[model samples]
Target: GVGAGGDMPNWMTFLISDVPLYLIAMPVAVVLMGKSTVIETRKFNMKPGMFFKLLLMCLPMMWVGSMVGSMLSLALSDGEATNRVADLAMQTNIWNVVFLVILGPIFEEWMFRKQLIDHTRKYGEKTAILLSGLAFGLFHMNLFQFFYAFLLGVMFGYIYMRTSKLRYSTAMHMIINFNGGVLAPWILTRVDLDQLDKVSQAAENGNVAAMEQWASQNATGLAIMLVYFLLYGAVILAGFVLLIRNFRKAEFYIAPEELPRGVRAKTVYGNVGMVTFIVLTVLLTAISLFL
Candidate 1:
């Protein structure tokens, strides 16, 4: 469904599948793992003002990742069509900006990062990382998204694991998604939306003379734009590093007793899960393409 169902997949169907399931299942997920997700931070604990220090430690890494990830998403994610979709989505009569930014983060963090993090512990962090990422990405229910989202999930999972603090991951996730995921493409799609199909078609039809001229005039411009984005991303990185340096400090984790034990050590995955995800992803891709 590259451009089917009016340029965005039928999110309504996912709303059906995901919203109810998550609402019902998330509470269950939380209840199941709530007690165990909490860990003993005593070993990691620090003096007062430690949270700020942790944030400081996290800031640069978050910012660096943000810049690089944003650059990748912008440079590579979609062509001009994505911008148009953003415009269309934004133009919705009830496009409440605050909800678009906040609701997604809160729910996703709770379900994907918090709950998933707590539950998959016994399988080992590596398994948890893959499962959590796969779960987070696949939960979105569409193809235009699954790959990047899964990658983002993995990254967020790492943040929680390495830092073992919910706030840092929460904050970073919100900013990244709000800016890069939700907003950047929103703006980009509207202004830069373009189609090169006519030119490509002409070229294919032996209009090489015109095609060569178009490439000569436009390719250099495109190359220049790419260079500008790269430099800008670097500057963003520098600022991020400065913030990190100023903010570095030791931190602690929450005690394990605060969290309840998850369902069973028996994961729904091991080898079976990977194969299942691949199959489902392929099937979804086919459905998206044909349906």
Candidate 2:
């Protein structure tokens, strides 16, 4: 039925599937989890600047994970995964932006960050963060996204722990999503592809003057593109430096009920329910590659 539905417009399909999952299914799941357990849902409250700081701190891990995922996707599937992502990006309209930018971050943080952290945090902060990150990655059920999602999950989880406010993480998530899903594609659409091709051809022929002229004619667009890439690159670079410099000074938390490290992780994740989710996600990820 899902495969058959692929024949429909991407917007329609997204509305039918992603919309309900975000708007309806996720909140119900969260509520059910809260009722089923004694654990209270995680909440957070922090100034907006803190999220930017978190983004900077997490950028290195996020960059490495995304790079690894991309290379693996290329090597294993010959970039089929990336092509599918690009196709989806090209299909984005207002509806897609709403889901991707607003609803998605809110619901996803509620599930992967809030729910997981709130439940297992009594065990240990480190364990809870790690497990939530793992669950977040696996929940994506796609190789191209799993790694970075996990990294971001850890960052978001930590923020939630600190502030106990969901709004901070939600805002951060929305910022990242908007940059990728809205700004990047919108900028790409504004670019003069024909001019870019000419510039490429000019460079290949060793005509620096022609290349300069082409750039001059499209100065405004080229400047916008340059600023975007530079700002993006600088954040990742700063993150790499900070991550390495502070690697050894990382914090750890002791669980109220201390267990062996392995036992602690097992207690958190090695349950029938979690194991079933892990299995299903792995199966779905494998199926996605072929599809």
Best-performing candidate as measured by lDDT: 2
**Off by more than 4 A, model 1:** 1-18, 31-96, 189-286
Instruction: Give the candidate number with the greatest TM-score.
Output: 2
Question: Candidate 2's residue-wise lDDT over 83-173, tens digit each?
Answer: 3454565555785577678877887888877776776677778888888888888876677777988998888887777776778878888
Q: Candidate 1 deviates by what RMSD?
A: 8.7
lDDT of model 1 at position 159? 60
lDDT per prediction? Answer: 0.53, 0.73
Clashing pairs in 2: 43-164, 43-165, 44-164, 44-165, 44-166, 45-165
Model 2 misplacement above 4 A? 1-10, 23-36, 39-49, 194-217
Q: Please give the range of 10 consecutive residues that has the lowest summed lDDT in model 1.
A: 79-88
Please give the distance, in angstroms, between residue 62's alpha carbon in candidate 2 and its true position after superposition: 2.4
Q: What is the Cα-based lDDT of residue 19 in candidate 1? A: 63
